[model samples]
Target: MDKLTVPTMAELAAKGESPEILFWVGCAGSFDERAQKITRDICKILQHVGIKFAVLGTEESCTGDPAKRAGNEFLFQMQAMSNIQVLDGYNIKKIVTGCPHCFNTLRNEYPGLGGNYEVIHHSQLIQQLIDESKLKAEGGESFKGKKITFHDPCYLGRANNVYEAPRKALEILDADLVEMKRCKSNGLCCGAGGAQMFKEPEKGKKDINIERIDEALALNPNIVASSCPFCMTMLSDGVKNYNKEQEVKVLDIAEITARANGL
Candidate 1:
């Protein structure tokens, strides 16, 4: 793995420098082992493209998405307000995040609490980079002609109308892009949204993640691409449940992008 350097907003501020954008490392991206790879890859992309970016580091907090989703409004507000205060103190005007939960909460829910910033998902940022020619998709990459199915994150897709960004990012790879029966506006959840991820499922007909993975498996995809860390966990668990981990790999969009770019 290549070493990565992520500047903290505090460090940049002390130097009388302001980053063009703030990289919000959501809870998963910061602490989840699997998600950490995606975090590093996004950092690699931003650094490679010469984007002046900084992270809040210890000043960052959970976006209160899970608390809000789990029906804890008071806790959610408290968390949101604390984060908003720190962001406002730093005068953060733009933010890019790897998790849709953070993106949705910051982009939509934060303005009400006085945290107004331009928020973008990593996928959208990658798409913009590609469009700007800061990133290029060259031939002969590892995924060329391999089948891949995209699992849309709820916050990124229907909740925010971001169906095109991840798809556009995936297009940079040399792969066969396939869609499950339920995708885009009609995509299925991986049984991890709305705080379901923290609690065991109630007795149900089937695990949502398994049911959704079944749809992906039905297409015989070589890779299951996801943009959210939560979705990645659930979908990867679904693949393991079916004992198909060897045949199929669950990957985040950032991981795929970094690999394609040889980062």
Candidate 2:
């Protein structure tokens, strides 16, 4: 892949220019090896569509989703306040996040603390691009005649009611879109939400992620598409447990979009 040119908020500000949107690279997108690929794909899509965007870079901090979910309200607020200070200083008005955890917190939870902004998940932005005919699915042949099943991130689907955007993005590829029994509002959790990812699972007949993957495998999809980093980790691990990693591949929506457009 060619090197990508992404600007930091400070760099753009120094030039007396402000980006139209802030690309919020959540903790996973910044540090997790697998998720960093999604981060780059998102940047490629933004640049391909000629959208002006900037990242906070080191100025970006965790959205405190884990802390809040772990019931550490005090720590969550401290981190949130610090981020709000930096974002407000930059005069950021619109944000597109790679992680649904960040999307939920920054969009829903922050406003109560006097930090309000137009926050959207990358899936929504991708849908918008496709709708405006900017992303014409020029390389959609990559996914043509393939079977795909999308795993809805809990925060993106149930919590925020963003069900159509991601499917619309996939629909443009002309692939056979299959739906799991527990999709849409009834989507199952990948067992990584609510701070569960940081600890061992409690006693159960089966892990939640395994069960979720079982549902997807039932459809025999070529690609298990997701829009969240946490879900990506869990689903990929589940596929490994069933010894089906070779046959089934896990991918993010942004990655699929970037690849389809040859970005």
Top of the candidates by lDDT: 2
Models 1 onward score TM values of: 0.97, 0.98
TM-score attained by model 2: 0.98
RMSD of each: 1.4, 1.1
Which residue segments of model 2 deviate by more than 4 Å?
none
Candidate 2 local lDDT, 83-187, one digit each (tens): 999999999999999999999999999999989999999999999988999886785348998899999999999999999999988998988999999999999
Residue-level lDDT of model 1, residues 1-263, one tens digit each, is 35678999999999999999999999999999999999999999898788999999999999999999988999999999999989998899999999999999999999998889999999999989989988876522588898999999999999999998899878878689999989999999888999898899999888999899999999999999999999999999999999999999999988888888788
Best by TM-score: 2
